[model samples]
Target: MEPRFLLMADVAEQLNVSASQVYHMVRSGELPAIKIGGRGQWRIERSKLEEYIERKYAETAEWVRTNPLVEKDDPDLS
Candidate 1:
């Protein structure tokens, strides 16, 4: 049996983006998906979606680490 897949609208709702953005991701291969029929039907695996989110968070964390934030005001010396 084939694994379940999510529709573009549903995926966008979950990701808080527009369906067009999802389509862009599909085109760029950032989000793994399979198209069915000639009507541009796109489907994504649940596991792949979760993995993508995790990887994005990891990249964000690494960026913050490499570029640390600084306070404008200096604290009192102890």
Candidate 2:
């Protein structure tokens, strides 16, 4: 069974991004996380990470809808 919570490094690996990027997301409140232990380690819930991914998918779809692609060689380009 997968762990309920994941380390910052684990989240980074899953997202294919640098650890610092994940840390920044947490710090910026874009991704919810919790700091635990006396040393203050960050842990992100697996469900929350999944939620973030889904949210990004929705946001990307909206962006694509609003920003239609511009094809090259279009008369407008000239």
Candidate 3:
């Protein structure tokens, strides 16, 4: 069967972050995940990962809107 969930390591690889950082995000509730199996393995749902990426994009857009870019060398500005 096809896979529906991703391991913490997999998520870390996709996010280009360390597994420890992913663990921290999960612990801080910044990312949604679940612990399963006897070893309490962490699993991130595919859809939830996608949602997190989309949310981050939206948040970055909002931040850029609030903080204008000031170019000191721009002839139009100065």
Instruction: Go through the candidates in order and give each one's C-alpha lDDT.
Output: 0.87, 0.97, 0.93
Order the candidate numbers by TM-score, best to worst. Answer: 2, 3, 1
Q: Which stretches of candidate 3 lie over 4 Å from their true place?
A: 73-78
- The ten-residue window of minimal lDDT in model 3 covers 68-77
Candidate 2 lDDT tens digits, 10-76 = 9999999999999999999999999999999999999999999999999999999998878775678
At residue 55, candidate 1 shows an lDDT of 90
Task: Please give the TM-score that candidate 2 achieves against the real structure.
Answer: 0.91
Per-residue lDDT of candidate 1, residues 1-78 (tens digit): 745788888889999999999999988999899988988788988888888899999999999999866665436432
Root-mean-square deviation of candidate 1: 5.1
Question: What's the TM for model 3?
Answer: 0.86
RMSD of each: 5.1, 3.4, 3.8
Model 1's TM-score against the true structure: 0.80
Clashes of each: 0, 0, 0
Q: Between 1 and 2, whose lDDT is larger?
A: 2
Candidate 2 at 18: error in angstroms? 0.1
